[model samples]
Target: MSYIRGYDPDTLREIVDLRECQERLDEIGPQRSLPALLERVWLLKVLGRLDEALVISEQSVRVARMAGTRKDLLRARILHATVLQARGALPAAMQELTTCAEEAEGAEWSGIAAFALQHRGKVSYDAGDYDEARTDFKRALFLRQDAGAADEQLESTLLAIDAADRRRSRTSVAS
Candidate 1:
């Protein structure tokens, strides 16, 4: 499943439509068909509808748990945490990510672990905890590098770190 992590609302809706078509053809099982829900959640998130996205993501997580697929569950948990973070529920988001990170570690899913850690870093950053954010982002960067993720993603993370540092510097100067 080549699930695109970030897509615009229109593209995400198109993906959801395609998945729905497959589901109608009975090609994907009910328990296994989580991509559509996830796509919808992503669409809502892109639209800045955090409440709707959170509800859908929570449902997706339940479905993923019932499907008993580690990859699906990981994606659901990540999306759910993202929704929580967007809603400013940083503590809850961190808790969810921490659980996901532990699960990834147990399953030796380095990619998923890295993804979870990246979000954990984002939550810390949002909560004004730059030290923890930097630590988490560094760990995520290392894991993603070890997992051989695309250079584009690594570059994006580096840019994010640079932006964060610049913002911190400006804040310090202002204070």
Candidate 2:
């Protein structure tokens, strides 16, 4: 079982009580292993402990760089970019995610590419750039389909696209 539970399997969004996540984090304690660190980072991020999440995410990136494969590094960087996004560093998150997505695509890792694009789309949406977000989400959906991603993953992207479309329509109407 994963360190933390009760989150959207595809989106990683919280669906459980924050107290449960915190308790799980506390139960997990500290571990230097990259997977453990990554789990901790996710939990902390979900718990609104951005500072702690950032620190652990950075550490996980370094660990992945030194000890893991390219795929691992890419995943770590993606999560790190997410932490940056959560911290309101949209530009930095976009830059990192864009690079990661490009690299993953160039490497023919469609699933990884889709993951990066999905997060980048979220960053764009958070920035109120619904057009860009929709574009990214659409591309991500295609990639995920090609990669044979799980149904939940496809559903998440589909939902994201719908949300972006709704927001874009509302923005245009308001303008």
How accurate locally, in lDDT, is each candidate?
Answer: 0.73, 0.89
Q: 1-175 in candidate 1: lDDT tens per residue? A: 4333432321111123444434433443333358878877766665567787788898999999898498889989998998898888889999999999889978988889988987887888778766677677787788889899998557645654654576567668888
TM-score list, all predictions: 0.77, 0.91
The number of the candidate with the highest TM-score is 2
Model 2, backbone clash pairs (residues 3+ apart or across chains), number = 0
lDDT of 2 by residue, 1-175 (tens): 4433343533435465777778878877987898889889988888889999999999999999999999999999999999999999999999999999999999999999999999999999889999999999999999999999988778888888988888889899999
Worst 10 residues of 2 by lDDT: 3-12
Candidate 1 clashing pairs? Answer: none
In candidate 2, position 58 carries an lDDT of 97
- List, in order, the clash count of every candidate structure: 0, 0
Give the lDDT of residue 134 in candidate 1: 69
